[model samples]
Target: MIGLNHYLIISGLLFAIGLMGVVRRKNLLMLFFSTEIMLNAANIALAAAGHFYNDLSGQMFAFFVIAIAASEVAVGLGLLILIYKKNGTLDLDDLATMKG
Candidate 1:
């Protein structure tokens, strides 16, 4: 039967993929997506552990994480849009070289 270990393994794999994306991606949007993936992976692990322990705290923390991710996306996207409009590109290297 599926258990916490199985869920944890899946979560770990997803987090690793997200980490790799964060390391390898160069586009601003892709970086945001990678961070979201990482957050979701953490949520999965937290929810699974909470279920295993029959406790609400981990699940509650996961909910908070989701809320934070939502806010982050809202603000991050706004900044990205402004940056793209000002710079005309979302490439990390290009953005890095930008100066006032």
Candidate 2:
């Protein structure tokens, strides 16, 4: 039967993938996507722990994480759009070289 261990393993794997993306990606949009993936992994682990413990705290925290992720996406996307409009590109390296 599936258990907490299984969910935890999946979450770990997802978090690792997201971490790799965050480390290796250069584009702003992809970095945001990677962060979202990491947040979702945390949510999965939290929800699984709550279920296994038969307590509501972990679930409640997971909900909070979800809300935070939503807000991040909203603000990050708006900023990304503005950045793209001003620079015409989302490459971090390119942006870093530009003079203010």
Please name the candidate that would achieve the greatest TM-score relative to the true structure: 1
Instruction: Report clash pairs, candidate 2.
Output: none
Clashes of 2: 0
TM-score of each predicted structure versus truth: 0.94, 0.92
lDDT of 2 by residue, 51-100 (tens): 99999999999999999999989999999999999999999998886577
Model 2: how far is 32 from its true place, Å? 0.9
Local distance difference test, each candidate:
0.96, 0.95
Please give, for residues 12-95, the per-residue lDDT of candidate 1 as tens digits. Answer: 999999999999999999999999999999999999999999999989999899999999999999999999999999999896
Instruction: Compare the candidates by lDDT and give the number of the best one.
Output: 1
For model 2, what is the C-alpha lDDT against the true structure? 0.95
Q: Candidate 1 — which residues are off by over 4 angstroms?
A: 98-100
How far is 34's C-alpha from truth in model 1 (Å)?
0.8
